[model samples]
Target: MALPSRASGGRPSARATDTALTLVVTAVVVAWTVVAMQYEDEPLSSTLVGWALIGVGCGALHFRRRHPVAVAVVTLAVSTVYYPLSAYDGPLMVTFALALYTASAEGRFTAAVALGVITLLAVGFGEAHQTGGNRQIDDTSLFMLAGWLISLVAIGRAQRTRTAYLHEVEQRALAAEREQEARARESATEERLRIARELHDVLGHSISLINVQSSAALHKLGKKPEPSAALTTAEEALEAVKATSKDALRELRATLGVLRQADEAAPTAPTSGLDRLDELVERARSTGIEVRTRTEGTPRPLPPPLDLAAYRIVQESLTNVTRHAQAQSALVTIAFTDADIRVRIDDDGRGSADEQAVGSGIRGMAERAKAFGGELTAENTADGFRVSARLPLTTIGGTQG
Candidate 1:
């Protein structure tokens, strides 16, 4: 069987205090009854029975919190009977006060009011009966009843105030938790988008260079007379691969460095739009892959993100050709229209049915285009695969820095 819950575990200090109070009050009541019997010359039997009733009524105090209404009713009944018979005041009045307090504290306001009324009536009627018709309404009894009623109302108000305070605290806690969860989710989404951007920048450029260099090396190898030249071309291509891998690692490490250190430095600057297109194409030509480049309309400076996005689209398309297509040549077209800049990479490569599911390269390219308020489309035509992207110049800004 399971242990009791934390809420059910009795408060040791509170329970001990209650028990001590009950014991002390019981002793006092018994002593008072004995003294009253000696002074009034009452019989010993009457005093003894009164002491027993007070003791029994005091026992009800232990269960006040658990059964406030019942305890209150029982104490009121016993006090009504024992008050007239005993010369001294009984413990029932004290017990009744405690019962009223417990009822308010435990959220039983209706029961507390009823008990208070009953107690006042019993006290008034018992006094009137004891003195016969000669007894008059006195200030002492009125004052005592007023004090009890005030105490009951005061306890009820205090309990209500505490309950309101606790409810407000709970609402604030729930709101804070919800806000924290929202912030975490937002941070995760931003990180994912940042990673996508980095992958597009790194892989797109590196793979394009590899495709170009490998083609150049293969062409030289075919010449048979240029073994040394072919070897040099292969070496250069390998060097490019190593450089690409190093750059990728550096970017990745920078992104993840925050997890390891509190004072890590920021990442290095990224490559921007159309900065090294000439060198990129030339390197590929040095290999065996033939690339033709064309530009239409006046070439204007573009936003950093748009320029980088344009570069990535072409780079990824060329990389795909080198890896999957057996084509001999590729074409890169850039058109600066009145409102937008358009890019297209066409290659004479074997197109497969699952072109969209090629690799992360395509997905990264698409993500880059979307980030800049642009669109990317890929289609496998009869001759080869085509990748195209269009970005609005107005939305992203004028040019790369």
Candidate 2:
């Protein structure tokens, strides 16, 4: 957007052409108007003076945009003196017209209009001077002069209007492009969050359940010498393993189904946000996990994305507890404030986590928190592992509905 390369046609810039064309036309008009003196029809002194004045007038047209009003006035004055002195019979509207247009288009409307009026008077004086002694101003001459001046001013104003309109249209196009890009980025982020939530829930829950089952089976075999108890424990562990694996597969399918063609319906089951957190707790309870959930401030509704992120953080942390912390009890605390919300998970067990070093679950939770301008921290304490997060209400706020 910054670099001005070219027009859409991939051609060289047209500004150069415009400048060249303007100067060329100005040169031609000046030459044609003064050709009478050049053809030896006027006195040598008058012709030389006329040439000098014409040069002064036409040469200033090149820098019109820079000092439009000033240059235009100077050129108009010079041309008026030259036109009458040389008694050149030609339309004296070339340089003045160009200068007036440039001045008005560059936002000097008053000066340009005043210049136009003065130029008309100058032309009238030149015409009267052409008629030897007594000359009465004719209506046709005055009307023609007025018409030319008005047309030039109107054209200049119209040019200004067209430029302003083009600029406005360009600004609107840029704004729309930025809006579209923002929407695209948001859609991509939402899709990523959806996939991450599904995977974190599926893998965290299944792996934790599998780890618990295996730990139970291992515990039962070594602690007891009875074959009947060991067999029952092994069968229970296998059943849990089978159920967890199947659930993981089903959830994976459901999550990926959204990527299919729109004609084919994906699963219509509601996504698990904070509303389904109770069901999550019950599932943990089924795995012999004792969870204590507490709330410290008044709870307000959350937007779906944030609610899902919050729920997934809790779910992943609890899953970590079930997987690694061989703790009998775990605590989850949710604190809400007018401007912010804090979530904390603590488990009192041997603290070595399942995937302790940069686990996918932890990374997903961190990503979710970061997406909403929040932060998450996890570390081992004296008692067990702790995962704490803080999210801003202003950034992630909306009603549940």
Candidate 3:
């Protein structure tokens, strides 16, 4: 027989199947040996020896999975030695089919085919082929033996094919699941970064304004000796602080509302965009920072996402002017082109290199520009610090892909 191959199907229930095959084959062999002795007058011990040999051969079949070829060879050899020597004149052979099935299922094709042919030749020499009065019965038994061998081999081959197919399908399913998990993790990371940027824009601007207003109120309350003048300045500072705090709370609530949404629906209130640029510029002006706004092209409405990004860029820039630029004057310029929108924020503040602080505001603005298939650059110019962004109009707004 061909050498044994690795089968995809695992071992069969060994104990039950092996025990059943052994019992059935042993009974048949013992019955045949005893009846043959009736004609030969052989001693009972001789009959028992034949039965013991048949039992041992059947027991070897138990190792068919790990050593199919070896089991088939041993079983065939044992049967050959006992069958012809026992003077058997009957068609009583059985049990050897186990080795043949296993060989065809797990063995190489050439080896299994050769082993089958050899086994058929051995069957031809058995008592089943001997011419006698019971020739019809013996011939029938021989025919059945050939058919059983063919059927068993076919069954084994099919089992191997099915087991291999199942294993392949299982592997593909696991791979698909793993890939899905990886995509989910990547999406979660992107969402977290977006939330961080929103919080930074809201907190950084509001806190800077609040700090400025509180300091001014404290100064006016102590510096001016006149009760009415001092009271008026302090009240104005307090009013500014209250307005800043309220706006901060409103913006923070809107940002957090995105997380509370359970479905894809429009937000209850509109988000900030270029339309709010006036308020932003006025806020900086209130802090004694002279501001100028300029437009190069005809003003037109922009897509929502691009508009929001543009507003944040100007807002964060002005906030920086208050915190680090230490500039007395700033310029906000916006240009609309056929294919893209351009934004520039320039400050004539402490133009020193040390005035530039590349922090979360800058990174967040750059990331926002990138979202719309755009780019942003921040650098210290001789006049002051300049932050510029170019956003492509092609995919500027609407829902993200």
Give the Å error, residue 388, model 1: 4.2
Quick one: RMSD of model 3? 4.9
- Where does the lowest 10-residue lDDT sum fall in candidate 3? 1-10
Ranking 1 against 2 by lDDT, winner: 2
Candidate 2 residue-wise lDDT, 61-117, digit = tens: 767766888878877887667666776654444777788877888778888789888
Residue 173 shift from truth in candidate 3, angstroms = 0.9
For TM-score, candidate 2 versus 3, the one ahead is 3
lDDT per residue (tens digit) for residues 299-322 in model 1: 988766677668767766766766
Q: What is the C-alpha lDDT of each candidate?
A: 0.69, 0.74, 0.74
TM-score, every prediction: 0.72, 0.67, 0.79
Q: Per-residue lDDT for 307 in model 2?
A: 77
Which should have the higher TM-score, number 1 or number 2? 1
Candidate 3 C-alpha lDDT tens digits along 291-330? 9999988778887778888888888888888888878899
Model 1 ranges with Cα > 4 A deviation: 1-52, 125-130, 133-137, 189-193, 196-227, 238-262, 268-271, 274-288, 291-315, 327-344, 367-376, 388-401
Model 1 — TM-score against the truth?
0.72
Q: How accurate locally is residue 126 in candidate 1, as Cα lDDT from 0 to 100?
A: 56
Clashing pairs in 3: 1-111, 2-111, 2-112, 327-349
